[model samples]
Target chain A: MFEAYLTLMVFGVVSVGFAVASLIGAWLLRPRVPDPIKATTYECGVEAVGSTEIKTNFRFYVVALLFVIFDVEALFVIPWAVSAKTMDIGFVVGEMMVFLAVLFAGLMYAWKKGALVWD
Target chain B: MSETNRENVKNSGEDSQGSAQAPVPGVAKPSIPAAAHAKPAAAAARPAAKPAAPAEVLPEPRLNNGRGRLLGSARLWPTEVWPNPWARPSFVRGAYWLAGIVAGVLLLGWSVGEISVWANLAYDWAMNLLRLRQVPELWAQGAWSAVKVVVVFHLVALAPLFLVWWERKISAHMQSRLGPMYVGGFHGWAQTIADGIKLMLKEDVSPRAADAWIHLLAPIVAAAPAVLAFAPVYFGSGLTAADIDIGVLYIFAVSGMTVIGIVMAGWGSGNKFSLLGGLRAGAQLVSYELPRTFSVIPVILLVGSLNLTAINDFQSGYWLGFIPRWFIFYPVMGQIAFVIFLIASVAETNRIPFDIPEAESELVAGFHTEYSGMKFSLFFFAEYAYVFLSSALVATFFLGGGNAPLPFLRIWPSWLWFFAKTGLIAFCFLWFRWTFPRFRVDRLMDFNWKFLLPWSFANIAFGAVYLFL
Candidate 1:
């Protein structure tokens, strides 16, 4: 176990060493000639003008919100899932059928509301 | 200053002129050692290693990624610059030295520790061999364990450059062009190494408005975990990182943290482009993370344990002589889980068709836009490393982790078989990277939520019912 730890440390150090060495090696060799034009971010051939903080479109957050809610709800269902088969087959089967039905109901609700649409 | 400027311009222009002439085009035969000659020749010609050549004359690698549409514009992929805003000219070298030592020590110490454990294990097993009349198959486990450490980590460590080379080769072939045919024998195999040396020689800049510490830490943050995540995956036949109980979970958590690093990288750079890129990545990873985790849940449920080793044990044998017992072959939920996991895994890694975070088009190389030098390379390498890691993981979770593909081939040994499987999956990853165009941010999020999440949950329902039946 200790050996594993040691190996990891050595690996980490070597990898990081390579990363830093490359950065520094290049730094030492490359010229540092910064100008207003040179320093600006490249956006195709156009020059960078000002801060890039234009307001984002609202579409992203709405879809993201729906994604999170649905995604999380799925996590909650996992424990119930694994143990389902060995339980009373009818009760278990019926319960999941209803569970999925309710879940789909909400999804249908969202779909009708146009919340998932990107455009 | 005037003398230095003249030297910079003359030497720098000379270097740039060199690389353009020898790029390996398509249909390459294995290369002869031309770079071997050029390195010594170039160095001898510029022995002084003059500091900071003029920017215009500096030899920048003008890459033709391929003749494809993505390759044509992918120059939009993030190029780094130096003389950053957060730097004071006088303190630069000192900063590099200090930062280098701290990072180097931590990483080296950790890797050495992992290796030492295997060495000790081998010693103990060898000493006990005379007393314990062991079967060779059982004893082979130890040897396999040791190989696992080296091949999984070392191969994974090095494979990215090859994959990048392969990507170039593939795109070149697809576009009816030549790939890297020069440097490092017969292919542009040495190109990545050369590029590595070049980047090291390059300077890192902390943009003027950037938060200095985060700017410095972002690449490290993005990259270090990419390497660390390799701890859980064993590349050999029957080997792994000492079989962590939370093996798959360990992968999930560590891989997830890469997003945090990416966000830090983007936000710290203080570029609008970088910030937007960071946000896209943050949003993308966080959004997909749920489905990705959910995909694994079914397999865990079926296996009845979180331990990757235990999971592998369960899947190792064939039910009959003809039937392989890999978990993906389980009933409907198992099949759904497999599909969900593959798609979600790809998205979680922020691969092509899902790479909105670093979307080159709208975001302009997105996060780390201001980063240059080795810092930039970290992000690039980490992308490939994580891709390999994820593919290995998917192979582990669904297909038998170290089982041979043919039922009869089990006689050949396990670790080799494991590597072969993981390697094939990894190639598929690179194939996908070159083959597809990226998904739009909105479309990407929608797919994860609408498609993957629901499918996984549906799989969950099927799993619950199957468990009862």
Candidate 2:
């Protein structure tokens, strides 16, 4: 088990190292000319007019909240799905049906409330 | 020169008057002519005016119609008059096509057995040489594993370079145009390499107001997940880097991290367009991931294992004497799941018709708008790499990883079949990209939630019934 994780760790390190090395190599070869006009933010060739630190739409916050809920649901579903074949089919299926029913209700509620509507 | 100078002065004077009405900086700056240097007195008189406009201004002559015709005609040649290779007789093209088909079939047959024989011979030769030395068992095992890691990393890194060029060529052909025709000989094979070199030498520029550390870190984060996702991908039988028990789960967990990198890029760029692009990417990825994950559940339930190799093994033989028993042939449920998985995979990779994150017409290069040089190339590499990875997974799960289509005609190595299937899927990705227009953001979200999500869930329920029956 530890060996498997070590392999993953090594792979991650090597890949990140490769990314850093290539960036450094490019930095060495690239020209370093900087002008104030060039460094300014690009807004289709117009000078940027206002601050970028403004609040976003509330729809995004709702999506983020839904994502957290669904992601945790997936965590519950995967383990059950993996072991579903080994356990008692009637009991396991009943439990999963209940779990999915609750989630389905939540989805339907969101749909009814117009939360899923893009506009 | 004097005539053009006078015309440019007239143009600038008109532009300044127009600017006084609108006062837009970008439009107002470009109309100033370089002839202002000739008249130092005018410049000195207007010294109190905006000093920034005239610093790098140059005169640009608007071409007249006759001059345009002359320049255009100089470059145009009649197709019939030019002695070109494509203008040859019809039979010549027919013979070339016939020759190519014959060569491809012959190569496929040779690749079936000869390549594996040579590879085994090389392995044996290396082992024999090692036996002559006093190497310890643990040391040998450690060294071999290290070699495997390095080889897999190279495949993960370099495959994208070739795939990028391949996508360009495929897209160009689909649109009836030539792409990168002159870079490195036959069909611009070395075009990506040339592009890599050029990107390396390009100036790395960042916005003055951008978050410096996150701007630099975003590409690394974007690219790292792609590399990590390659860990559990089985190239062939007994040929995976790490055949962990939960291989499929590992792939999903790691690939999800790429969204964070994209979000970082958006937040760090200090551009509103970048921020919008990044948020779109995050939302799109999250929405599509549900269907993608659910689509895989049917396959998992059928195979009763989360291990990718086990899943491949379960789909090894045929159902009937003639038909292969791949999951894709599992009747109604399998076909529906495969379609859902494929569509979700395309969305996950951000290909056309689903590419709202980097919709060039709207967002101007999207989240990576402020990146240049190597940083931008890293994003490009990650995107193509994900395309390749997803295509490979599609082939592995549905098309039978490294397995021959028919049982009796197993001439080629399994890895060759794996690659051929992956290439077919990758070509389909390019086909979709070129054939379809991008989706509107609302429609893109609607398609995922309304259609794909419900269908994926239905597939799982259908699979359960099929299994019990």
Candidate 3:
């Protein structure tokens, strides 16, 4: 298991090195020709208007919140799914059904609260 | 500027002279009057911009010919460009085509046979030659690990080049056009190489208002996770770079980091389109990821291990002497889970129908819009690499990674089988890109939440009951 992780670590270092190397290669090969017009933010030829960091729809925030809830739910689900195969089938089924039922109820609540509905 | 002025004068003189005559017999009149009027107004506004007209009256019939038709259609095609000779077959071309096919088959056969085994032996011999007497075991192990890392890197780097080229060819053929016909010897094999060189040579642009550090780091972040995700993927029996116990979990957790890079690109660019693209990517990837993760649960339950090799091993035996026990073949629930996994994979990779984040018509290239040169190519590389990784996972989980269909036919190497299965899955991805239209943002969210999410949940429930039975 530790060896497996070591492989991942080596791959990570190598990948970062490769990315940096490619970037450096591009920097060396590319021409540096900067102009005010060229460096300006592209907005389909029109001059950009207003700030980009405006308030977005609350719907996106709601999605983020839902994702957090469900992601945590998944964190619980995987181990159960794996170990459940070796446990008593009836008991495992009953327990998972209960867990899923509560999760389903939460989804329903969010749906009713208009959190899932994108305006 | 002076050249454009002269061209404008030439265009206006031709347009006015052409419009003064009777309308063409069958052609539809040009739709926009503003375009017709603007040309003459420019001519009137700047008298010096106009060229002196020769007394010679060129035949007005030139406007009604093929050139006129091309202009009227509002499409750009240079009439002077020579038609590709490959479109027509000569004896030499046919012979070359036949030779290429034969060579490809021979190469495939060689790779599936002694070539790979010999390559491994050669590497081991080289390592043995370099081994120190003091710590031979440690030295050998370190060298082997280095070799493994190099192989993984090669897979991560080179696979995308082939996949990108294959995607272009596949998508082009699907749409009835020739893709990359001229670059390399046969069917533009070196097109991606040329593109890579061009990308490196082009000016690397960053917006003046953009955050320089985050903008530069975003591509690295985006690309690194894709490379890391390959760690747990098994290429063949005993051929994994890292055979971790929590292989599935590791892959999902790492691939999830790609969203951070996209979000950083969006936020760092200081462009509303980039931010919107990034937010949409985050939301879409997050939403679809649930179903993608859940879809794998059924496979895990059936296989009884989180290790990818274990899952692959579980699918190896025949069910009834003829049918292979692939997870996808497990009655009803397995099929449901596979279908859900495939759809979610499509959305996760931001392909057609779920490509809202970078919808060219809407977002103007999305999160990486401000990026150019190598920075832009990094995102392109990461996307194709993800496609490969996703297809490899699909093959491993569902289609039986590196497992032959028939027990009697086991001559080919296991890695070849794995790649063949992956190629088929990757082809399906390309096919879907060419076949489907982009989904609307609301509709995309609805399909995931309303349709795929519920189905994935149901698939898990069905798997539980099926396993119990």
Per lDDT, the best of the predicted structures is 3
Q: Which stretches of candidate 3 lie over 4 Å from their true place?
A: B1-132, B136-140
Question: Candidate 2 has what TM-score?
Answer: 0.82
- For B58-85, candidate 2 gives per-residue lDDT tens digits of 3343445436432234323222253765
C-alpha lDDT of residue B152 in model 2:
88
Give one digit per residue, the lDDT tens place, for model 1 in B1-469: 1233334435655562343233332322222254543553344234233333323433433466455333354434444344773464424864777699667755554344334356568756764673376646434454445554555557766878777787787778778666776667645778887877777667666566677788877777777678767775755433555456556666676777788889898878768888888878877788778777777776776676666777778787776665678878887766788777777778777788788877777777878678887788888888888777877787787778777666766654455556556767777776777788888767886787688767766776676555555
The residue-by-residue lDDT of candidate 2 on A1-119, one tens digit each, is 45455567677877788888889999999999989899999999988988788898888787778777877887777777788888886677677777877887787788788878886
Task: Encode model 3's per-residue lDDT on B249-311: one tens digit a residue.
Answer: 999999999999999999899898999999999999999999999889888887778999999
Candidate 1 C-alpha error for residue B34, in Å: 59
Better of 1 and 3 by DockQ: 3
lDDT agreement of model 1 with the native: 0.67
Give the number of the best model, judged by TM-score. 3
What is the per-candidate TM-score for chain B?
Answer: 0.68, 0.78, 0.78
List TM-scores for all candidates, in order: 0.68, 0.82, 0.82
Q: Residue A41 in model 1: shift from native, Å? A: 3.6
